[model samples]
Target: MNYLVCVLLIGVGATAVMDLWAIARKRLFGIPSLDYGLVGRWFAYLARGRFRHDAIATTPPIRGERLIGWTLHYLIGIAFATILLGIWGLTWVRHPTIWPALIVGIGTVAAPFLVMQPGMGAGIAASRTPRPAVARLQSLITHGIFGLGLYAAGWMTSFFYTP
Candidate 1:
């Protein structure tokens, strides 16, 4: 239905905004953007019955992993957007306020902290990283930016929905 399409569009748009922030962060602060290829490698191993890695970056690279990782990144974004819509309902989408979107966007950090990082061997919330505090802060900031992106996307969506 139209609602479904709207959710997908908002999700994709918000995620794109997040990515743009990453690029800007890298350019302005000398921070490196995440190499989603590791994500792909981890996921590729899922097919072979491997669920965890001591160090995903050291794991053998999977063929087409770059493609897979990038694709998964967007898919996960879409999933998060779907979660937002499910929790807030279509009425929220029609009105498109920033607070709900921001909360959902910030809340999504759990997936990376609890699920993705641990699975990739970075430890829960990047505990095993060389600089755990820095890693955690970076994650928080990135997710916060994602929250802003969600708000921006929601505003755009509202603009389109208005009569």
Candidate 2:
């Protein structure tokens, strides 16, 4: 139960980090991205009394499109904890630490900065951008948010799922 809770909390935290990432990206770099329409797309599909998600997100996903992005987002959190348990076994997972969450939360920013950004045409680490500094700043801000999210999610997990 605690493990499940941690996974969920981590997932939310990751989402927050991504949200902040978009803001940071826009503020730091003159780069363009999608709008709030993504929320609608995410929820709208669910609102139809179905578990189905939109085939095409309003704000098209960077890699593997919408389905892949959404699945990856949540799965990463679940998998992170799962992998931790797989390696350390249940004993380590029992204690639950913030550092692990923080590391995964913040570390994922590289996806957007180095991988996703470039794939999305933003350039490698913002190298092809007119404002590389701003691009780096955006990645930094997003990663910071992810770190905060990890801590927040860990606290939440401890509160709701911890013994």
Candidate 3:
């Protein structure tokens, strides 16, 4: 299989797994998942030359914000997959290891902690939230789960692609 095809499959599959975890988390723990619509809104504002928001939830809704956010979410996943491939090369893709995938997945939390949260006005690492510790833990767990998803997806990809 083409390398690009492998990347796309692994990325999409991993993201889907993460989405499944979000649903399970919400249903099992009565905890809500990140609202990707807000992500879309943030991106929309960024496109308009605005970077920070006092509270993205209060921000005016933009047309197609949900679609934009969902699209960006998957694209970000794909980008991360690219990063993994870039670092590890095709040899890793052929072998599909867990540590590298987990490292990249967990490392992704920095994006939200430094950029997305601050831009959305949640404060760094959700310090501004009512339950900062819980939020942080949740973020860590979710990202870890995403890492597992990456590993799982990598295995799935390896099954179909020898190279």
Candidate 4:
């Protein structure tokens, strides 16, 4: 398979899996998923040179913020997928191991904890949330799921192209 096509397939497939998990969690546990619209708003402001917000929800909504946020979310997933491939090489994609995918998936929490959370005024790892520990745990779990998605997507891709 083409390198770029493989990346898109794995990244998008993994992100879709994570989204499905979020939907399931919301229905099963009543835990709300992060609003990608807010992420979009943050990015909008980010483009205009704003980095931090007292509370992103309170911030003004930008046009097409929802779409922008969702796109960014998937793009970030793709970037992480790229990172996995970069570290492990295309050979790993053919084999589809769980460890590297999980490592990258779990490690992705850093982006939200350090950058997204802080920039959006949730504090590091959601420290400012009403239930910081719970929020942290949720983030960890979600990212872990993303890792599993990565592995699953890798396996699915492997089925399509040999070598």
* lDDT by residue for model 1 (19-128), tens: 99899999999999999999999999999999889999899999999999999998888888898888887787678888888898889999999999999999999999
Which numbered prediction scores highest in TM-score against the true structure? 4
Could you say which candidate leads in lDDT? 4
Instruction: Give residue 40's lDDT in candidate 3 (0 to 100).
Output: 99
- Alpha-carbon deviation at 86 in model 1, angstroms: 0.5
Sort by TM-score, best first. 4, 3, 1, 2
Q: Write down the lDDT of every candidate, Cα atoms only.
A: 0.87, 0.55, 0.90, 0.94
Residues 45-129 of candidate 2 have per-residue lDDT tens digits of 3434543332323234343345545555556655554544444443443455667655665666676566555543456676766
Clashes of 2: 0
Cα miss at 10, model 1 (Å)? 0.9
lDDT value for model 2: 0.55
Q: Candidate 4, residues 30-104: lDDT per residue as tens digits?
A: 998999999999999998999999999999999999999999999999999999888998898889899999999
* Model 3 lDDT-worst window of ten: 154-163
User: What TM-score should be assigned to candidate 3?
Assistant: 0.97
Better of 1 and 2 by lDDT: 1
| TM-score against native, each model | 0.95, 0.56, 0.97, 0.98
Clashing pairs in 4: none
Candidate 4 TM-score over all chains jointly = 0.98
Cα displacement (angstroms), candidate 3, residue 27, comes to 0.8
Cα deviation in Å at residue 59, candidate 3? 0.7
Query: Using lDDT as the measure, what is the rank order of every candidate, best first?
Result: 4, 3, 1, 2
